[model samples]
Target: MREAVRKESEIFSELAEICTSPGYVHAIASLCYQNNILIYADKLTPEDMLQQFARDILVRTEVSTLIGLACKKQLNIDLPSPEVIQRYIDKTDSLLKEIHQSMMLPMEYIFDSNEVSDHNFNPFRDGLVLREPIFYSGESAYYFQYRDLSKIKYEKDNDWFLRNKGFSIQQVIDVVMSIQSLQNDKAKNVLRGLFDKNPSEWTVLSAYKFTAKEVSDISNIEIDTVRLVIESFVSSIGMDEFNSLDDFNPKNAYPIIQLPEDEYLLFQIYSLTQALYETPFFWFNDDKAYKNIANQHRGEFTENFSAERLKLVFGEERVFSNIDIYNSKDQVGEIDVLVVFADRAIILQAKSKKLTITSRKGNDNSLQSDFKKAIQEAYDQAYLCATLLNDKKYKLVDKSGKELNINREYKEIYPFCVISEHYPALSFQARQFLKFQETKNIKPPFVMDVFLLDVMTEMLQSPLHFLSYVNRRTSYGDKILSTHELTILSYHLKQNLWIDNKYAMMQIEDEICVDLDLAMLTRRDGAPGSDTPEGILTKYKGTVFDQIIRNIDKLEHSEIISLGFTLLSMSSNAIEMINNGISELIKRGRKDGQHHDLTLEISEGGLGLTIHCNDDHESISRPRLENHCELRKYTQKARSWFGICIGQKVPRLRFGVNKEYDWVQSNEMDELVQDLPKPQNLEGKNKINFAPATRQSKKVGRNEKCPCGSGKKYKKCCLKQEWRM
Candidate 1:
């Protein structure tokens, strides 16, 4: 078979070249080959041999052509002629009419053939009529199937076998059926012969089967239904109409599976599972999904400080590791831990009671409020934990009058104590609070994983799938709003509808479960009065509006605006910095409260002020504050103190200083120098004197005229006028 196929390949190659030149010689040669005119090999010219070879090539190359040719021969028709094509078609129609007239005959033919087959005793293989067909072992069998013979229909006739005319559906079916019924050796011979006789019809048949039944279940159904389903399924596949069997379910006639008794849906289900299982797994580890998830599980944070402090430094690597020293010292409340070399001490508070919340009877949203309260309590506990770790003196104990001590000797000693999911909302809140504190230069030690996990769980409303969302937006980040935060926002909005929350609906498959309601309820206030779009966005904007706050610095400072707007927005603790700056200015004893008008005050060299002060009574001296003022003195000391004055009628200064500084004074007031320094000490330096020189009254000559373009007398144009003036 291999040798024959190789020879056939060579013939086809020649035929390809012959096809390029469509002359009668090549054409007739091709036609003779198409007709399978293989004469005695020793009695033929090269052209005749080539033609005979081409005929064999076309006959054996395809299954449908082989079957068609057999049909033609069975009906006793010549190849490559109009009459032969009609006869082949007629034979196919007659065969189908005969089969439909007596379906039992075909069934009996199948039964008798199977009984003689080797595996006839097996129930699964043989009891089912089409499960095991006597097919020639080949690669094409991978896609081959026992198709229902009755379903095929030709959309159009493509009969190239009988001199370019076409064969009908019945003709092709009959030919294929007859081919299938032959014995293995006889079938091969018949197929080779049919290929020689009707190459085009066989090609069409091969193409039809090629198009049908990709991944289908056909274990049960009536024969007629099977025929329709198989026909539709095959046609669908051939035409590339739908991408998957899932799409073909609704269109088929036989409920898709002809054999309905078996668990056919299981096959489709398994197929779907395989598809999902085989999907790329790059997301498991290094991908954002994994990283986001993995970071939630943290490890030891070994930095420069911890590296130097070895457990063995004090002659024992296991110092306190096996001991329960804190267990004996059951003193409750806060304890201070010395940081050795640092001046700061750490505070540890023992929280005796496990943090929990209670609902108030008057509140309609007691459950929700309690949930948030618990979360905040947890956050505070975590922050307290961080504070203890950072300073080494704080601890929390549950309500059982139990003293909980965090031992530094343990490997898993996180900055915060472990809390339950009941306080989930607190995790993110606590994290944000700690971050704010850190930004304010407060040192709070928190486990990186604790912070990430807590924040992730709260924000995502899912357990720690830390790896999943690390590189993607969490629900919190999705909209400037969180669906979980909407409940709180609803109360603020004075509306009961928390209905348009989509993030709450997300199905997150992670370990930590969160009540998304808490997330959706948290929202910022709206803008001042107007309910415009800008107003709404402004209203909802929280600390995230820091960009706009920074921009506000560009405006002239108004004390009322600073105190009422800026300070009111800032934390009370943060106002300490502003108060200290203002106090330092006040102690200098300059009055005029010019510093109160922060815009002018900043221009006058006080730290640019805003209304962020805690109290108005902190300052009383206004007139004395402006007494030391000197805006632009040109003395050596002033010049040395300020850099070169550029493009101005005022003294030099920095970006923060303006022309208004002339009205403000420094505490260090000194006398201005009147006499200029002598050149004897400043020759190499840039110092210059403005004193007049000698020989200034010399007379001008007549020809020494001005160079101006007036075109007047040399003395009158410019030089004479200068002398007279």
Candidate 2:
């Protein structure tokens, strides 16, 4: 008895618990059988069994979600949120319900070849061998197709179906049987409403006009037997039991009883036989299935397989090596991965997907150009090693100083892919393409699929897969264009139009000859012919090339011509503008035998301004094109007395001269003083030496009194000016 209890076979322990707690006992028995464990041997109670089932549901859901997250992280992909996952689960469950409804019909109706009136219809022949309904519905039905059978299809019986007035009695019986047996009556009616103009209203429409007694007589089964059969079938088809079988108490359990033992007995035999038939398919697994199985036992398989694959591929040496990563100045590019070997550097630019390239001349063909341009653009912007600054140093520059190689021709360049978890096929395909390129020795511009795949698998694990390297010069270009260059270019174009309009106006002035509006106008003899504004502007569009030309003209004509020339190197737009404007201006200036000395002055904070004069003299000049406008060049004298120094006892660093001292000693004094310094005071001074002895000085005397009238020492008081002041 002790040995028997220790073994706790299913029959003994499970049946024994039926007298105590049937529901818990049944669940325990099912779980024990599934796991090949003995529940009684472990002394599992009804409460324990129920808790275990709940725990299992939670565990499965958790494990699935965790695996999903891991895959997403590995591929650097964004996974759907928990709410989204929940929605997907709900949708899957809904679809399962629909499948179950389709599967709930009787085997006779599902596979019968006879007409509506045929008394003999066999379901077992059409692979509807299962007497229980659970084998046919929802996830279980899906499972069956994969586990018990290789395929499924409905056979057409056109002759039989046509003869039944487009309505087979068997089809009606099947639909009613499915509807009546289903616990979800709402779903049942909704399904029935889809098929006919009218449907009978009844709780369980198993038959028409026949009472339970009459139906039982015809079917050779009791009412309870019929109900039990439906319930068992539903269970077998993967429908969860809402209530335990033992809890099912029919109102008329033995009403019209017939073939009582044989019915249940036949169902049991069918269930056992089907399980036996599914054993081979359920147990067999291919590589794909093995992966699923391995994932299920992830705790054991993950670490071991990781190590094994690493050993196989990389041996003992670590695959990753460290290198310096600099913050790229260019916003449009980043360093996907950097590898430095003895004589070369490998830079990878990874993308989420590959562009589709075509050879035909069409929009799709532009993908090749786009691909080439993108890679070249990224390369152009990438930081060149400071040591490798000039092409001349590498013997790669021609005699004319042009680069001998295209930026894309560098062997170390690699463009890889960053991918989502579901795109393994694309990754694999891209890898094959890259490998093809490598083997064929295709040039740098060619897109290779193999390198792309490797990059996708290896580098995409990092969240920052979108990063690329951008060169400092191009980064500066981006800043310039976004700020000053674009605006200035546009302004130059506007100014050029203004000048052209003015020139046309002058030409029209020369052409017109009229006494008044009442008289007919005639062109003045030998006067410049006027051109219409539209005619002059007709050929021009605001294209980059046109802007370049206009900008050059503006630069040459600017009062600060040299400053405008310097702008050329600062920005590409500036360069284009300067070239066009300066070339034209220089040609015209040479013809006129005059040139403006335009120079640039840069302040401490890098603010630049242009000063222009007719010669080396530091004075402002008017340009012919600028409406002949002239403005004075004066050093802005400090308006307050605190900025100038003159005479003893004079205000310390005051802007104005002392009243008691001779005004002749300071230039500032000469400028500030009114009248001829009083005629009496000038009479004593030597007339030959009386050139108003004003001298300019940058510094003031400290011995002078405070300018603000504070009695303290000059240096200690107002002479020590506040910085903000």
Candidate 3:
């Protein structure tokens, strides 16, 4: 038998194509007219279909606009009228909302409890770190370390820098004022004097050197308040909060140690200051300390996010994240996310790089370099991980480095690079590169832009459909192997079994088991006396019968006979039920007697059933007909009974009765008798006549013929007409 084919999403692909065709649009319009739905058919032209609808449809326009904006305003398109655009935008937004509501996964939200710790930098113990020198010119009155104060003024110019560092302009002002309010009158006056001299010329360490007593003498404020104010100002700059004025010295000071809240505020100030002082700050800079940290966190977030999305789409059991694969040679690789289906594996590599179109014309050298590097790195890592999976000897481990034992082995692996940002030109280039790689026999990873990933998570609910889409997009080879076939292959590979022999044996066993189970269910005598074994067997002759007969040599004879008997027992019970329901026929078989001669026997490479009786001829033959008819009626309701006999011959025989008991004859009986071998003579014959009695000495009437079909009159023959009534 030919194997069942795997289901494909060809219809969806075809629909996608048809949706873009002008002819299809026209046909749809025609359908609307036929249905009496008014449409502006005359206004619909090939150009209108291609330009007006194709390019300007609500969903397409909204998606394109999003992509364009994401790519740093690189994409250029003609704008439609505001009214028309707004209408489409609203429609698109509504559709998206509906889709999201329908497809969102029902996952329980979990709260993270890890606290954000403080980070601080000090010029003294932490070393004077200058991101870039504020001034490189000849020496001035202020020392180089004091120039760090220049950052404070620069922070006021860069709002975005502050926001990125987790702060607001108001928060910054509040923190500064809070520190100022802690200072006493004398300390405040000293601060004012320092600012007037040159706010950018004084370092925190230098301010710490001025004694509170000197400040108190200068401003005539309380000495204790001055000391408290000086200590508050020092602590604000990330100094030891409990340090004594006598122990503190500008020459030997502690490193800046920021408290959790203070660290966050200071980092914001420092970042904003750097941004404002620099000539230009590249948004996509790879070297910045904060950017590097952000990228690490973002990459982790992307992996987790992708895993969750996959879990929603495919279920949690099928998705594994941060899987580590290592060979004996110590070559190691990690998969960001692995989605395993019954027969396919999807390996995802999440890249946190911010992709942008540096050149509108798509010829920017730096953009091309960055895109290629990212794609290549992701692909190489994915390929390495896939290679490990291809061999059963190497196991893929979870994040904790514990081996994962997946029951199913994949026939196909789809590697995808999921990017954080949209870069249309780079994406197109990546696709072309992948296509080129395919020619070289390397299955390159597909580039999944964030938008496309979102859409796929919504659309491909089934893993089979997801794999089908991947195959179509990549021009992968035809999907000829079934899930069962792949399962067998997996077993063979894992067990190191001979492929040809084991696969064939497994296939045969599978077929036999399936056919046997189906036959049993349909032919069994269960409640609802609606079906019979014989009818079911006959219906499945071409399919189930052919399979059994072809593989009979491989199957055990006892097994087949057991199945046949099981079917017979069920059928017999069902027949008895039907007999009870019939008012005309009394059932011959009894529970107490154990004399049911109904036998299901294997003969001549087929199954046949025989029934016997030792009663009067009429009682035996008439009941046979009733039983046959009743069984046939129930069997008619059955599904299939391919290997069992349901013909008229199997039910017509009578054993242990004399030839005189042959009172009924039909063409069906003749055909059945001709097919069977010669019957054995009975060992003990006790024939009892059951014909209705007649008056033995009745006088013959003149015109009546013999009752036995003789030509002579009743007086001439041994018949009496008066006996008929």
Q: What is the C-alpha lDDT of each candidate?
A: 0.25, 0.25, 0.36
- Work out how many backbone clashes candidate 3 has: 6
- Judged by TM-score relative to the true structure, which candidate is superior, 1 or 3? 3
Q: Write the per-residue lDDT of candidate 3 for residues 164-242, one digit (tens) a residue.
A: 4343333333333232232223233444565665533322212212344454555455556544333322222222221
Best-to-worst order by TM-score is 3, 1, 2
- Model 2 scores worst on lDDT over the 10 consecutive residues at 513-522
Question: Between prediction 1 and prediction 3, which has the larger lDDT?
Answer: 3
Report how far off residue 694 is in candidate 1 (Å): 42
Model 2: residues >4 Å from true position, as ranges?
1-591, 602-725
Q: What does each candidate score in C-alpha RMSD?
A: 33.0, 33.9, 30.4
Candidate 1 Cα errors over 4 Å, as ranges: 1-483, 486-725
Which residue runs does candidate 3 get wrong by more than 4 Å? Answer: 1-287, 355-361, 364-367, 435-444, 476-725
Reference-based lDDT, residue 136, model 2 = 18
Best by lDDT: 3
Encode model 1's per-residue lDDT on 331-396: one tens digit a residue: 322221111111112221111111221221112244334433433343354344444433344333
